[model samples]
Target: MRVLFILILLANLGVYALGQGWLGMRPEDEGRDTRRFTQELNPGAVTLTPRPAP
Candidate 1:
């Protein structure tokens, strides 16, 4: 039982490291256009309005 628990723990750690991008760039982020974020027009002009209460 202890061996199984240790194996599971290591697997979880490996997944966590991959998700955190500790190894390298994440696969999902490849070929993504990052310039759009910097090219926003009047980004500060957007405002969040509170919804009316029922």
Candidate 2:
């Protein structure tokens, strides 16, 4: 039972390490591209108009 507990503890630690990017695996490197959202086509063309009264 002690060995099983140790194994479980080690597994949890490994998962935590990977999640924290300590294992050289970054979240941004895994197909999470943010370029499209950051690069807007026209910044000056956007205008917010007030809603018409009912």
Candidate 1 C-alpha error for residue 48, in Å: 13
lDDT of 1 by residue, 1-54 (tens): 999999999999988888887877666777888787789789799999999999
Identify the runs in model 1 with alpha carbons over 4 angstroms from their true place.
33-54
Model 2: CA > 4 A from native = 27-29, 33-54
How does model 1 fare in lDDT? 0.85
lDDT of 2: 0.87
CA shift at 49, candidate 2, in angstroms? Answer: 15
TM-score of candidate 1 relative to the true fold: 0.54
User: Worst ten-residue run, lDDT, model 1?
Assistant: 21-30
Worst 10 residues of 2 by lDDT: 25-34
Query: Against the unseen true structure, what C-alpha lDDT does each candidate score?
Result: 0.85, 0.87
Encode model 2's per-residue lDDT on 1-54: one tens digit a residue.
999999999999998888888998666567767577789899899999999999
User: Candidate 1 at 19: error in angstroms?
Assistant: 0.1
What's each prediction's TM-score?
0.54, 0.53
